[model samples]
Target: MNLLDYVLPCLWAFLACVGFGLVFNIQGVGVLICGLGAGLGWLVYLVCVNFLTGDIFSAFVAAMAIGVYSEIMARIRRCPVTGYLQVALLPLVPGAGIYYTMRYCVEGETQLFLSTLLHTFGFAAALSIGAMLTSSVLRALLPKLRLGRE
Candidate 1:
């Protein structure tokens, strides 16, 4: 396991998320924070994938990390979680999976289409489920995490 395999990809993920944030007009410190969060989340995903060797598990962990970090950043910065979460999750979104699934379908490869479609949907469901779990836990704890405390 070479270091570049992980570090380089994580750096790319961070930059990609930052670019997406800028394109979407996320202002102030959020742009930087969102980018950092994406890198950290990607690191978690890569490490998980390296050890566990499963896409679904890695994506779930990465999505959960993004959700939790976004929630905390939102509380601290008084910004909406969606602003960071959406962009920070850019690394984990299964865009290529969906693209390939559709391509396979269009190419009349039924087996490949079904397999790719299921994998794509599985990844999406994993991310969604992780985010939902994080939101539920965070919502229950948010009141206790009041800002401006001494």
Candidate 2:
């Protein structure tokens, strides 16, 4: 893949995050910042998937990136991390995977259903683990990182 691959997806991710934020009534610069964070996270994921590793690893790192971005920005902006993190994380959600997995199951395609279900669950697990790890790692280094302080 070339620059277009990265640019287009990142742009789309940014727009999606922005729209989600708006629907949540997020105001001011927070919406734009969260959108940018989501875009950057998606860009990192794309790069990881295309050049470095599989979807699990890509999701893991992408999640970590978004977590770090949200945590840091929340401190600087004097807002709740959830305000940004929740919206920012939307881009990485495996909604399509979940839909297809359920669809296959409903259609009684045992083999495809099982495969999709497993993959979807695994991807969700990766996202959860990545978020947990990012928060844990950041918490451990909070003092060193000098965040969450005036």
- Per TM-score, the best of the predicted structures is 2
lDDT string for model 1 (1-150, tens) is 899988998899888988888998998788999999899988999899888889898999988998899888887887678878888888888999989999999999999999999999999999888877897888887777764311
Q: TM-scores of all models?
A: 0.92, 0.92
lDDT winner among the candidates? 1
Task: Report lDDT per candidate.
Answer: 0.87, 0.86
Expressed as tens digits, the lDDT of each residue in 75-139 for candidate 2 is 78878788788888887889999899889989999999999888888888888788778777877
Model 1 lowest lDDT segment of ten: 141-150
lDDT of 2 at 146: 69
Q: How many Å off is the CA of 28 in candidate 2?
A: 0.5
Candidate 1 local Cα displacement, residue 25, angstroms:
1.1
- The TM-score measured for candidate 1 stands at 0.92
